[model samples]
Target: MTFKIALIGCGGMGRRHAHGYIELRKYFDTVEMAAVCDVHHDVAGTVAAEIGEATGSTPDIYTDFDEMLGDADLDGIAIVTSTPMHHRFAIKAMEAGLHVITEKPMGLTLKACRQMREVAKKTGMVLAVAENYRRDPMNRLTRALIEAGAIGTPYFALDIGVGSSDGAVMHSTVWRAKKEQAGGAPLDAGVHNADMLIYLLGGVDSVFAEIAINESQRTLRPMNEVAPVLAEMYNHRREDGYDTGDIVEQTAVDTAFAVIRFKSGAIGQLIMTDTSHGQSLGVSTVSGSSGTMYRPRSRSGESPRIVRGDGTEIMGDALLDLVPGFELDDTLSTLWNGARHISSYDMDFRDIDSKILAYEYLDMVQAAESGRQPEVGPQEGMDALALAYALMESGVSKTPVTVEDVAEGRVSEFQDEVDAEMGI
Candidate 1:
């Protein structure tokens, strides 16, 4: 039985998800895109046309989500809307007896995440977070190696990246610059880093952080200079009046430095900034008693390297030897064309990205069908969000904050405004 799913929020990411459904069909014929919905009819119509052209199946388009939910005849829905709407739509869909997979950060705030989780529990609907980073093959291999003791007795990790956005808005979306809409990179892209760290290492205990907005103003990159995809998205936002001008007064924090303590007794330092002036820096390495493992940025398809205390290095196909039984699971193997041991993939950004999202879709569908949890279910999603929020929450009070406290809504100074604004 093919699982019928509909796409909500037909924006840039929504279009990518539509393409993901197209890609999923190449491997598994167990799902179909039944409908598309957006606040803007033209946007939904355009995406519907694209899906039809690519998959030979046109989806019905709707401007109202309730109308689509009532009339689409879908078994599930993919919530690709903005961050604030994630929990709102997921709860409504799940309460309406449909499974939901929403884009991260799972909810507007911890309170919102809890509300969504409660609805899922009461409705028994499968709710998954569309986190694509940990789904990368390289990340899978890194997790396997860590579990196999290749980097024995892990103790600490450093994940740092500093760069200058030069006043350009991220993704050309104005909402991302608004604190009430997004908590900047620390809550936007940082969630991916948080989830990957948790997947590779373990649960985080507490975080002490300093967060700041180094730049309060941003401008749009020239259309010709930006990628075609982003340029098109910017045009759509402008047409829809979501972003009116090239300049945006950013209200979100753009820089963060945090020290994390893991429940496994491992420590981590996370530093992220998009307001640096001159030189840029990046580092991602996990140190253990025996060796240091170098990790590439997630979804980059780059190979991870390990350097032993004796100065010996292992990488590429040789790294697979560290774990004799290392292999992708049956589903991932099928999605990756039966590759068992792969250090890296030879696909472009869009191709690999869509493939990863397709795997996510398949995971959600199978979990809903089998009455199990998706790989990144509500719990995992909430954990990652809590980790990300720990940074902001700690920064707010100028003190270390426990992840548990953040997740349980015991410490929420940073998120209070957003939660209040969202009325959650």
Candidate 2:
């Protein structure tokens, strides 16, 4: 039952995925890292050595994906590439007779996500999206509490993700800020926010979003000491083949604010920005008819507060103590165990998140063994992307767009541009 997996892309996220594979072997059953692939041979070699040292197994390294697929005997491929290439990589892996797991926003476009889903259906391969945030403990706990009536009859919610990535120091400045590859922070991180909303609340009925580019490459850091040559060399290209500079002409929206109506008749608001002068973390709240749940900070271990309409307030460890009798569903149980692992790992959120990623691999293995779909299956990934695309459409049309509209191809604002750029 050992699943031999090969990893594609050896960047920052790929390193974490490699670590996840190592830990999956330690914590779960047999899950072996067979090979690592990246266009940058040095990066791939470095990651392979690191995994070898960590797991005592030297995984084969390759610079090309096709070489890895053609030679390595892999049961699945973990795609850590950028958003636009998700479908291409996934379809290739599935078509090669291997299961696939991909990082989010599923794919850059809804069309791409559907293509992946259709390919999986035709090939009978299991495809899962690595939505680690949905696997976060607090997210699952919140969902459980709402379902258990701890938050009473849920009616409305607010989720906010405000951060400054336009600054040169931010990791996302390279690609996530671009329109063609990532569709800005709204499509990049916004999909996660929207997915969290859908996971906790329910399917979204409609979305009204306003997207804007408040900061057109406002430099937060002066690369004075560093040579411009080094900076320019590392600056990377945008979707339009232009250099991102101190005064870079950024086309993607640095800010997005959206109002969402769930199919269950609940309403919610989502705000995301990667270009705020003084950026804030993910501060979210979900309000019900009788009480409200609030997460003041975005980090994994931060506890949420619950306040009742009658002024009863519960927070922190006390909240857990009060919910001693809460029932545990399968998903909630897995999240609880995952949360416990986070606490046990000395508050390393990166390690904790990586552990969840490991669990995602385990989900894929389970799907393969049982002939069932993965927990975060293609449809769920598609639904999340559909909401994200709908939000973008709403932003462009200055009106509300239904989830079905986007799911059914009634509205598309950015997909064609992405498709053409990707030559799909």
> What's the distance in Å from true for residue 277, model 2?
0.9
Q: All models: lDDT?
A: 0.86, 0.74
Top lDDT: which candidate number?
1
lDDT of 2 by residue, 139-195 (tens): 655676777788877899888888765454334244655677765777777788778
Q: How many residue pairs clash in each candidate?
A: 0, 0
TM-scores for all predictions: 0.96, 0.88
Question: Scored by Cα lDDT, where does model 2 land?
Answer: 0.74
What RMSD, rounded to one decimal, does every model reach?
A: 1.7, 4.5
**On residues 55-155, what C-alpha lDDT tens digit does candidate 1 reach at each position?**
88999999899888888888999998888889888988998999999998889889999999999999999999999988889999998998999999999
